[model samples]
Target: MTNVASPVAVVTTMDGRRPYGTTVSAFASLSLAPPMVLVSLDDRSQQLAIIRRTGRFGLNILSTRQAALAAAFARSGPDKFEGVAWSPSEGLPRLPDSAAWIAAEVDDYISAGDHTILLAQAVTAESAEGSPGPLTYHQRSFGTHTPLAP
Candidate 1:
């Protein structure tokens, strides 16, 4: 996995009126026909519990400019959103400037070793104006990608 850079995104879940978010590089598309996606989280993650309870989540695909935001959510603590700019998207908090935002409902979950794999089906999706490269996580660092010449 270190050889290939994975796109980074901030996954948000709400517990009642309070919101929670974390940086996730293990997010990927599961199916394109039904618009399904998957996100892997530590089994002990608080956001996992909240997502299980609410059966809902928001995936904000971070742009290269949001690297600092990615680092903020990567830490384990309560004040992750300290001064992050965000607003609600269909009741789930979302980063307004993300390259893409997806609102989804939990379809299924499976326990795989130390992580819980969440399979979600998209309910609504949106993307920012103008195409931009995504923020990526690889080799324990954050970076951006450039297109390869054909």
Candidate 2:
């Protein structure tokens, strides 16, 4: 629902030659014992096809300051990584400065309506130092979390 705010994540995967990424707000942790996660992508997305083919992906949890980066990835038809600083983690491209990142291997794909849900196992994960907070999507707008004082 639009009323429910969700954390924003960029899903990245190599398409044989170049890396492809997209801003995704439908990511969630599915398990901790096996370190699993899930992300939903549009059925028609090229990036989704790449992930399916490669069987690997990286989920970068954006920091509040990275809202512009989120917008860049959300757009279609352009090099999303152009001028963006990033590096590879376990062969998957990752935003080195993101709040957190997970390198995952797709375990299953479930078709649901117009989207495909990827159930993955987190092969590796790490958190950046001094992250301000996570970027969030609410009512089609980007925002950040605020702490309440005692």
* Residue 49 in candidate 2, Cα distance off native in Å: 0.7
Which stretches of candidate 1 lie above 4 Å from their native place?
none
**Which candidate number maximizes lDDT?**
2
Minimal lDDT window, size 10, model 2: 77-86
* TM-score of every model versus the real structure: 0.95, 0.96
Alpha-carbon shift of residue 126 in model 1 (angstroms):
1.5
lDDT of 2 by residue, 33-148 (tens): 89999999999999988898899999999999999999999999649999888887889889867999999999999999999999999999888889998999999999988879
Instruction: Give the poorly placed runs of model 2, Cα more than 4 Å off.
Output: none
The positional error of residue 111 in candidate 1, measured at the CA in angstroms, is 0.4
Q: What is the C-alpha RMSD of each candidate to the true structure, in Å?
A: 1.1, 1.1
lDDT of 1 at 42: 95
For residues 55-136, write the lDDT of model 1, one tens digit per residue. 9999999998899899999999977877877898888989967889999999999999999999999988888898477898
